[model samples]
Target chain A: MLDGFAGGFIEILQIATLMTMFVGVIAGIVASAIPGFTITMAIVLTLPLTFYMPPIQGIATMLGVYVGGLTGGMISAALLGIPGTPSAVATTFDAYPMARKGDPGRALGIGIFASFFGTLVSIIVLVLAAPPLAIVAIQLGPWEYFSLIVFAMTVIASLVGRSLVRGLIAGLIGIFLATIGPDPMMNSPRFTFDLAMLSSGLPFLAVLIGVYAVSQLLGEVEQMRSGSSKGEALIEERIVFRPLSYLMDTIRRPINLIRSSLVGVFIGAVPGAGGSIANLLAYDQARRASKDPDSFGTGVPEGVVASESGNSSTAGGGLIPMIALGIPGSAVDAVLMASLMVHGIAVGPRLMVDNPEIVYSIFVGLFIGALMMLLIALSSMRYFLMVTRIPKHIIVPIVLVFCAVGVFALNNRVTDIYLLFFVGALGYVMKKMDYPLAPLVLGVILGPIAETNLRRALSTSEDLTLFITRPVSAVLLGLAVISLVVFLRHRMRPRASADS
Target chain B: MSDPRSNNASGRPDRPEDDAAPQPEGISGDSGLLQFAFNLVMLAGFGYLFWEAMALPESRWEPLGAGTFPRVLLGALMLLNVIMLIQSAPQARAELGHGPRQLFGVAWRTMLEFRTVFTVLGAFGVFLILIRPLGFVIAAFLFAFGVQLLLGPRTWRNLVISAIIAAVATVGLQVFFAEALNVFLPRGPFS
Candidate 1:
């Protein structure tokens, strides 16, 4: 292990490790500082480029980006009312309020500080949890793998929010869309539109960029046209980072951090649940736990803490399933999985057995990356906050331009550019209406998995009752049904008098 | 157009009671217009999608055919659109007056100040085109400058900085992917 680190570090130094870290942090900050664009989109667009690089360097760059991106989202949320990423959505509710109250410094400080701490906790879990889980995963057969996918799919209802029916509809819609490409198992074409590229199915990255990034750009443009004023740009005050003191203080509220991190890890452990739901669930749990719940939506530090903690932890937890079971736990992790394959690194149980040295290297890399993220995030919180002071009109165009380039960079195809615009429009409308965008994104990411497996299962059994007859499938199906019922009942309930 | 049984969700109270009297403006500000516009656009987009899917080649299998997934998605999208339109019509009219009046008015001044989106896209387009001809460094420099122009920095200092950002991003990507990972980026004139 020591020798491996020594070799990896030597290679890392030769590859301009500091430069990679710097570039990653900058790109992450820019991506996270802008609304409509996300770490997932940034990572997705960049993944193609990794196909061109050496394995270790490419992997390290991605890891750096992941850490930086997670913390960067808080910049916009703290400075402006807008959240740079969905995970930061909870952050904005309080951070923006606190900023408005003229404590932008403290708000930004607390968030960055909390994010650094939370990420550290998650990294520890990743280091410990992954190896054992990989061992357990080795015992699984095709039936178990199929059941695991079903279990992940059943979690969709929990993410659906006020409308499980709508969420299911969205999920089904996503599954249907996933069928556009050739079948994974039989190599038979499914829904190719006679166009050659369609045979490969819809490019998940293109869809992600289109649905999330482009949609956001269009929405901002529309909103900009309406002449909204964001008030005076927030002025920053001095914020001291007392890490020891901060740690002690946060440890006193260990439940909040532990609870949020666990929720994040769990959500992240499930393929497709991703960061958005993790942060949302964390925020919800935090609010529920707060003695003065009313203060949550106001300028409370706990909201910032919970969101940053939750979202950052997801980065660590997301890699667990991917490394252990060869299943991507989130979109970014999906990129990681793809990158590994491109580099001829076989994932799953065999990866650990064959490349224990590399596995240990990755663990070390991730741990160091987490610490670096915390250090960089803490020191630079003030700078990120300053980014929010830029005018919305200015920020929007810059972000949009980046989005276009990023999208085009993926496949260098004009079709993807158009896709970006189309998805941008869809996102704009969805935002304008109050429909949640996370589930749709989640649906797109998870759709193919569900469809491929469902078809594979059916083809193997050729029996309609196979889903119910299998014990694991039956359990997952039951969970989905019960979740649907619970979600509907919750939505149907009369509005709470106080909130109304 | 004004069917009495429409049960318009946009219906404002007609009562003249001074306190509870509906505002003179109709209910649901201009959301009705917005919603209608949104629905029309979605319809057009999804309609094309459905048509395209229908045009695809079919397989011998019933559900596993080439057009199976797109057709299913198209149908679901159309259904969802219908429900959304139906749901929005009433709510749009009801909330018409409550919508962002100023957002649409002259206050939308900032959008005109800097045409960042177009310039950035144009610059990026040029970058891709010139990558083979200009080499990574040259193309990257132009891309940076173009993005800076789009950003509309008030001073040359900021413009220079923005340009540097573009250059760095380009160079970094080139170095990592091409030099390190050995992935091919276009090596035009300057390469």
Candidate 2:
């Protein structure tokens, strides 16, 4: 383990690797600080660019983006009172008020520090948890694996979107889309329809760029049409830098910081849940725990701490499932897994064994990324604030062009760009219809594994009853059932009360 | 625990219910009729795919055929589409009661409201088509410049700025990819 850590440090500390990571950090901050651009979009566009770099360096660069993006969101939330990303919604509750109170620098400084500590705590938990979890995960048979996927799909469907049925349908659509080209086992083409584009199957990267970047940009255009564009700065107050004082203030509420971070980690480990939920949940928890809970949204330091820490910690917590199991906890983690898979690196229980150096690099890279995020955010926040002012009209067209270029560069195939357009249109329709896109992306990633395991388990045993008779597999399936029932009840409760 | 933040110091109502309540499902008003129609289209597509899957060859070595998994998924999709169709029928009926002329007006207004989105989407389609013939640089340049002007204020200063941005993005991207990444983009006439 020590040697692995040392090797990882060596690989990541290279001048070229650090340079790209620095650039990635800047790109992430700039992208997320723009109101319409998401961290997922930033990472998705960054994917093709990383294809040219060595594996460790590429992954390291993305980690920088992930960490920087998490903190970058606080910039717009505090300065403009509009969340740059969904995860920063809670930050606006307090940080915006703080900025309004003529303490904009304090709000940003506390958030940056809280983010730094939160990442550190989550990384410690990740280091402690993932390896042992992988060891146990490696022992699971095909029955258990398939059952686990079933549970994951149900949980994801239940957690996301308003209607459980709609979420499930989106997931099913994704799995069906994955089934378009070839059958995993038989090498037989399933739904190619003799078209060359569908012959090799839809590229996952193209689907990602299309469903997220293009659709999201179109949504921004709609917002522009709706006349929500704030051409002038909302707050013109000068920011005062008092980083040391704010750092002390954030650290003074250690319990709140730690507890909120734990909430983030737990929520992030859950399939389909990510920073958006974590921030809110953590802030709620912090408010509940406070003796003077009434002060929560009134520029309280604890509020900023809890919200920023909560969202930032999810970066580490999200990595836990991706490292320990092959299953990604969220869409961002799915993209990370895709990046690794692009390098022909199989990401699963054996990942630590096959590429211990990569695992170690990840562990080290996250810590360094967090440190770098703190440094960059504290020093260059004014510039990030400037990014929030970029007009949606200009941003929309420019990003769309980037999406096209990135998708086309993925395989140097023009067909993929066409696929991106169709998928983007489909995604836009789904988004407008209120269907959540996360489960669909997860389903695409997990569909092949689910099918292969189901077949492999059945082939290994003629008795279909063994699936239920086996303890672990049965437990997983039982959990899936329970998850569905819980979601159904949760959805119906409010309507039932209203009827009464 | 009861959320104390619900009634915070900030006079702003911290209604957690806003996040908890699902946004009004699109299955209401005119959109409901559209949803019903969309569900019908999905049902047909899934049904056809299920039929196609039935013909997939089975392997003697494995109990599950190549088609089995996809068939199961398609079946679920068809079933869900049917459920959606059934759920939206009442709303669709209500929408239809508004009469064809009213419905036509609503649909026309919606198209007009989304005209910008549709226009940009159309430009994107054209760009994709042009990529093969005009090459990536020229196609991207035209698309970016055109869309920027269309979306932004139509002024001379904005036009010059948009043109410069379009050129930098296309040419700079082309050069970066070619020189640094060694990934040569399609050159077309330039090649």
Task: Give the top-scoring candidate (TM-score).
Answer: 2
Model 1 spans with C-alpha error above 4 angstroms: A1-132, A135-253, A263-311, A314-365, A464-475, A496-500, B1-30, B33-76, B85-191
lDDT of 2 by residue, B1-191 (tens): 00112211112222212222222222212266776888898899899999999999998998998999999999999998888887767667777787888778777877777888899999999999998899989998999999988888778988999899999988998997687556677887864
What is the Cα-based lDDT of residue A102 in candidate 1?
Answer: 66
Model 2 TM-score relative to the real fold: 0.71
**lDDT (tens digit, per residue) of candidate 1 on A226-259:** 3343222334344343555555545566788888
Q: Which stretches of model 2 miss by more than 4 angstroms? A: A1-119, A122-131, A226-366, A465-475, B1-30
Give the number of the best model, judged by lDDT.
2
The DockQ figures for the candidates are 0.10, 0.27
lDDT, residue A332, model 1: 91
At residue A34, candidate 2 shows an lDDT of: 52
Clashing residue pairs in candidate 2 are: none
Candidate whose DockQ is highest: 2
How much is the lDDT of residue A130 in candidate 1? Answer: 73
Lowest summed lDDT window (length 10), candidate 2 chain A: A227-236
For model 2 the local lDDT of residue A420 reads 89
